[model samples]
Target chain A: MTQGRMGASGAPVVSFENVRKVYGHVKAVDGLTMDLRPGETVAFLGPNGAGKSTSLDMLLDLRKPTSGTIRMFGSDPYHAIKAGRVGAMLQSGGLMPEVTVRELVALVTGFHPRPLPVEQTLKRAGIASFAGQRVDKLSGGQTQRVRFALAIVGECDLIVLDEPTAAMDVETRQAFWVNMKAEVAEGRTLLFATHYLEEADQAADRIIVINKGRLLADGTPSQIKARAGAKRISFRLDRIDEPFLLGLPALVNVEIRHDLVQIQSTDSDRTLYALLDAGYRPREIEVSGVGLEQAFIAITAEDDRDGNGTTPGRSDSAGVASYAQH
Target chain B: MNSTLALARAEVRRLGRNKRYSFFSVGLPVVLYLVIAPSARHYHVYGVAYPAYYMIAMASIGAFSGALTGNAQRISQERKDGWIRQLRLTALPANAYVIAKIIASMVITVPSTVLVLLLGRFYGGVHLELWKWFAIGGTIWIGALAFTALAVAIGYRFMPDTVQPIAMFVYFVMSILGGLWFALSGFLAKIGDVLPTYQVTRIGTDLISNQSVPATAYITILAWFAGFVVLAVIAVRATAETV
Candidate 1:
């Protein structure tokens, strides 16, 4: 998921080496290893039970991983944070109802050696207008933005976020990404976990997928998609026999209902041409690259796939080795 | 601005602005002290001055009020919301957070103690000299730090919803047994002496009565303050580590 520090080569700013965290008997994070580099923005993606939040907690050192090491700026994340190196925003927005945004930022900056100008930090967070508004009066998205502002309100080097935009509308989410891109452009590092595949695709140079407490995939967005393989191909044909289409090479699985035709194919192009050969004039043709959503579903939907769908290699040490060997 | 003073200013603003926090910290203490002081005027346990008795009880009420409210719930909410973690992102040090909490505790405690004393003096038949004010203020300041440590320990160790009940219980028990009249029973004095409230009361009443404080109570109060400071130091470390 994350890379180790690259040394004079510019090592990662955040690294998780075979980290494990358990709540009761439930393994919230299992053998998860990941890295994030300075000026690099990485997206962590997974299903409902995929341990994204737990991994964040471990990375932030709010909850120590039951096993393994997590480092930020090449030190224990919590220790580094105490040393004024890391900033974070959890899923639930953090703002004291009693304090205004300016007050909050001012209060938190008190925890640092060289805090940013309060007004500037508020402007960066887009809550400058609400600087005097108590937190309880702010809307959810505003509160989230305020929380985001507070995180970077410190001049900390690393930013860790869990579901940074879950409450925002599409417009605000985009605005947030644009702001994040600007921050990353400033040579800061970011690690955020989210369920929105589009978010990962847009915000992260690298995407990591976790399923059932373990890492299922980690790479550049295309790399993860490449590993997930070409999973979906949909089209509208003049007319194509379902059985005939299913019989085509790499089209062994096909579903046709009404005017919509869907197929899971290893070689989508091969299947597309065959439909053309069969005198099929389509009203619409669509082919999806193994995007993060496809990658996420493919990586997590294996249990019900029988023997048909692709599954990443199950490596107990596979995830661990990724970090150890690095 | 000085960090502690800034923290205290913000804390006072919080208590004033939020009607709920204000009511709990400001209004409740005044109302309760008013009601409590008037009711206690007629009662005395073992010849204790009812006025001084009420003052001591009300002071602990102030202590619990100040200690329990923002110190824990606010911190917990901030912790839960990722605010503290966000603070870590800033150049802010962890000590500021502890300082802020202590300031908030004092801000809450000061007004609460003042109002309770006013109620005791005006209506509760309590006569207090300037020195008595100084002694009470000094002891209460020490008690504020002690209570803050307890509040933080609870806040860090328990969920917000869960912590309120425990704090309320401590407030109730400390006010009742450790005090004389608002106390559930005067008979509980033997058991009350072990509580910080009782030691604090012993210290306060001694000062108010213009008599020498028992060396034991001063030692106990000092021990109480030291115990809390030690615990708060540990809790602040945990907050930095865990939050």
Candidate 2:
């Protein structure tokens, strides 16, 4: 929220200053303070019901915060929407299922005073050939892409996507990131909500993870993972040696009954060197670094009541409420 | 006015996309006037006015289509699509939306009125009187405004998907069983006298068959339209929910 002049009115592309969205007795988002600059892509990583969409919705002004303030493009998102500056591909996407893709894009663009030409929009959405096809006839992944096209057609400054590629596959998802990188290169800001760690690792300049409705980690993709960092160091011995590795410095506190070692040390480099020096030139060695997915799991799992992905709903409410107190 | 016209054009296009209401807006009144109004003197006690009847029927199509098709459904659709939320945040002002809706109804109503006249001239053996033309056209337009308001007001309460079937049923049931379909007379006839279609229809019959429309009937139809207008204005404000 610390401001400059990206917006027409001198606001950041998006700023959430202690924003809290309360629904009845529950706080969907609590004290979420985030900022996005123009042309930056930030991925919101969280498990289901972790308030990722709720935060996105509030920023999009589809849902209003019960308290605090969110400024998109230096004004309220609702204001930005009217100004035709805030663009979104909501979780619902709001596609008229009966209309052809061309018509859907045309109708949405019609709301803007100076939308991109229909042909260009169709091509950008990657559905130029499917423009005449009915939306109901398209696959879910294809429909998701159409939503993406519509959001960008206004040539808006900020784009908010809530689970944009939820229905996409491995190949399509890879291709989508390529297409998205190209789109982002055109200087549009993106606040993407995604569950895929690899997607975040590949597509995001920065990553923010939310657990129990509060910001658990926020930094560059590599930084956040490094902060919650652990590594899986595995080697295939001639057989299993449990006590031998446990007694060594690199493999200290090793659960080495099997041919596996999980080092919780901050320095994987030092540990791996120790392993090699201890006459442990193994047949095979695998040292996998900490990843965003594991970091999310580790953070949420710390507060988890059960092993399930479900965070005690009340805990998020309490956690978010606690945010306001601070 | 240009803004209103722009919105109106879009609404008209959107309304035409619905098959059920496309018939109500563009097809039903023309088909019925063509097939039925020629021999209205047969069912009625003589001295019937064909053009007045056709005009009332035409005007009511504007009223019906305005309430049931675009205005009513648009309210729900906007709310569901977050269009209302979007507009409220804009400088467009919610009143502009209401004005646009009423104006759009006129866009459809005016054409439907012309089509009805053409159908009456070709198939019903009807002719419009100079004075009767202004009287019936004015009455029909007033009726459309009222119905359009009520339709939008009610339409705002439901989602678009659920609105169509219920609205279509109301229009069809009223048109047929409420005596707009036939000239049934009695207690039901008394109730029909108050219905916009019934009163507008009877007023049109008087204007065409006898070269005179009842002043009382015109006032009653206009009053009903006024009530709808008031409700519509209220509905727009309530749903606007602006601070």
Candidate 3:
């Protein structure tokens, strides 16, 4: 299964150079630029309508970019895909119906220049038990697994998936990542687009965040968290000095409702100390670390505010909550 | 090319499993021929024996129904289900899906055409030279191929729900007016003169009667085929981004 999985050069496995896809008046992907290295598990993080699907579509050569270019394996995406170097399972990707799972696997596997044994792929996708079942008759999760099986049916060096676990339950989602990890361990580069923040945080070595059809942030989990603000501090003060509180050290954002002030800071201890050193006693002080979910919210919400100038400070939580639903 | 052929092979196998396809393309025709051809022995159509003419009619009915309905509905449903998109992700070439579908349609037309002619031979007692049989079958087979192109156009250009009625409408109009169900005369004959289905039957009956087929018959079939191919190309290209 991992025959050609060795000793790739330093060249990036995939790269998008200012790629854009315009649909009439809407810019689906606007000047998006990024690159993926070999053996890297990168998460494409975005909200609904954040151009994640469009970008992945362009990368897979399913949809052409209106401007600029995308390259895979240092070649055009279409040629690289035709060479059977990249395997993909998109949310829109569907199975051939009216056939047994095993037959569908075998048929697709035969399309590859270097194909794997069909039984091994069926087993790896955890679909061996239902291999005899018709594809259209399976449950949603089983159908998803079959789609995943098709992606790994060949000796691919890169795998791209869009919301692969969207239909899976928690237990199935965990099992899926375990199976996915085994595939990536063969030194294959994996790029998956997902809105599930924890999945992105847990599975990806690097996370590339996009918002409104552009790159918002690209870094490791910790760096993204830090860049958004590592700590959140909320306190109540008897004498509310909003301006003075906003001026606190290491403050990233400040939200005030009467005497209750919520603060997001890079260093919570420093901000709190500065508040006390300013001769103000704040009551009910609470300081906590920010999870990747909150950090993602902060990053995207900030972008939304900057981009549209309509969703104000309160949108940080509201916008993210709505985005998480999709 | 190999991948496309593999896809076409799988398509053929799936079509074999479909009871609806089998009934429309072979079973229905064989049953219809058994029931209708015996009683029509005294009648004649377009200078050919009634049994032989009905053979062409039944064969044309089966081939047209199978080629148009089975393929159009499947293509539209597959597009809606994202099967076409999934195939696009494979290492197969871009046009492989459409080509494979056309190939499968052509392959499937064979059994139906041959079955109807065989019924005409042993059961209907319509005798003809072996080459005439081949010519008739081959002509009907090519007509089915032409309809397959129109099916592709309909499938690519519309969703499954819309394709259902459109394919049915086309099937009824072509089969009835083109004299697949009955021989045309007077005004209906004038109207049926231009249809590819009527022309296909004309070609078959002309071959059976040992008459020179009209140039207009060939021109009508070719024009429809060329027009349908262009329509299929345009539909496929229009949906390129979405597919």
Candidate 4:
């Protein structure tokens, strides 16, 4: 929707060109390449140790990439940041102690060449209530908000956040996204790394999934679900033809036990219509949507299974089913 | 440049609010001078009256201790807490943090040096020419600046746990061996001759006694300052990725 309005013709806000970061024997980020456009809210989704943090670190120039380059607004990431064109809040980012929240925010705001008013930033971040409180004395959740307050202290085009709501309670998390939506509405690009699948699905316009330091999939929420065999269709049939069933339209995976058959499909309607066209009458037909959580688990589990071929008890579909139940 | 100075100003404000820092860096020196300089009125060392000599020693102690111990510990803790990492995300220049810290340390050291010098003038009764007062204060301030570089080196190189003991060890060794705690003689003075802390005190004493300050004193302090700056640069560079 944003791309339609802004027209994806401008220079990318961020671009990673085959970036690789290696530590001793481990390649933290290996040959990763992606681009984020203007006014886009991109969600970086990855399992633990999937090089998400490493990639973000390299993007912000906190850690040098062993090879490849990251460009922000056609210049290098560091220069773009120093030019006050980007703002970032790392999960490891901490606040200065012994100062009131307002003082800390104001201090950082003064660093930007074009700064937002400190009070406006505080209000926007939902931190105005505790502006007078000392930063070190805040609770874990309150501290997270203050760190977020710091990130938006400056007027920057791109805002990068790493697990921005990790410590927030449910209500605070809701309020956070509300404030965040207002920020993004102002034509700024946002990139956030998150473990919360539903949060990503709800907030992001585009989602990039990575596993084992490699891009597994990159698409919108529905596209990612579709890639993971989005819908499950099951029925009991009097006559079962396993070979023909495998050839069904949009079929991703098929399993048959005696007269009962189960199929995973990207387009359940097309698969169902195709089955009827093939003269198969199935009873007790049940179709269900696999949510983004299951899709995410399936994607990463498939990658893990592919990477480690020997250890095999469960498959991707089964993992999806288990997570779907949860 | 304005942003860096703004950060430095904020740091100075925070330092003012810290009671423990104020007591140790400024108050303790005044109390120590009031207690020690009175008893040593009849004595003399380094070709100047005892109060005059002890005045320099106490001022050096207050300034150097504040520069070394307080800053080292705070920097290490801040680094560990990812405050340095947080600052890097801002538009501020890369070297701004260390520069602001050094600036804050320098600004905070002034009042301590001045207060001790005033006590030496009125309470301790060690009067001096106007230029001499400025010279002595400037010398101690510059010496603390050197120690601030050393603090940055230690802070960037080690964790807070290790910084505490290391800074303490350096503080005590430099203070006693440099004759800041008391006047050294013979072999002790010979060893103290090589130390920047001792050289700083000697420059102040030499200025008061109407003798030309030794070239060795200036060379020793400047050399240490250069070495500490180099060490601090290497430490900051080495930890760039981690921070």
Share of reference contacts found in each model: 0.57, 0.11, 0.75, 0.86
> What's the chain B TM-score of candidate 1?
0.85
As a whole number from 0 to 100, the lDDT of residue A189 in candidate 4 is 94
Please, what are the lDDT tens digits per residue for candidate 2 over residues A18-73?
Answer: 78877778777877776787777888888888788778767766567877888876
What is the DockQ ranking, best to worst?
Answer: 3, 4, 1, 2
DockQ category of candidate 4: medium
Taking the candidates in order, what DockQ does each have? 0.44, 0.24, 0.83, 0.77
Runs with alpha carbons beyond 4 Å of true place in candidate 1: A1-9, A110-114, A231-253, A256-261, A270-291, A303-313, A316-326, B1-9, B18-53, B69-91, B94-99, B114-133, B180-186, B219-243
Model 3 chain A lowest lDDT segment of ten: A317-326
Task: Report the number of the highest-TM-score candidate.
Answer: 3
Instruction: State which candidate, 1 or 4, has the greater TM-score.
Output: 4
Least accurate 10 contiguous residues by lDDT in model 2 chain A: A1-10
Q: Record all residue pairs in model 2 with backbone atoms less than 3 Å apart, i.e. clashing.
A: B48-B209, B49-B208, B49-B209, B52-B204, B53-B204, B53-B205
Estimate the lDDT of model 4. 0.89
Model 1 chain B: weakest 10-residue lDDT segment is B85-94
Ranking by TM-score: 3, 4, 1, 2
The DockQ score of candidate 3 comes to 0.83
Runs of candidate 3 with Cα error greater than 4 angstroms are A1-9, A235-238, A256-261, A280-285, A309-326
Q: Which portions of model 4 miss their true places by more than 4 Å? A: A4-7, A234-263, A270-285, A309-326
Query: Model 4, range A88-187, lDDT digits (tens) per residue?
Result: 9988988889999999999999999889999999999999999999999999899999999888987889999999999999999999999998888899
Better of 1 and 2 by DockQ: 1
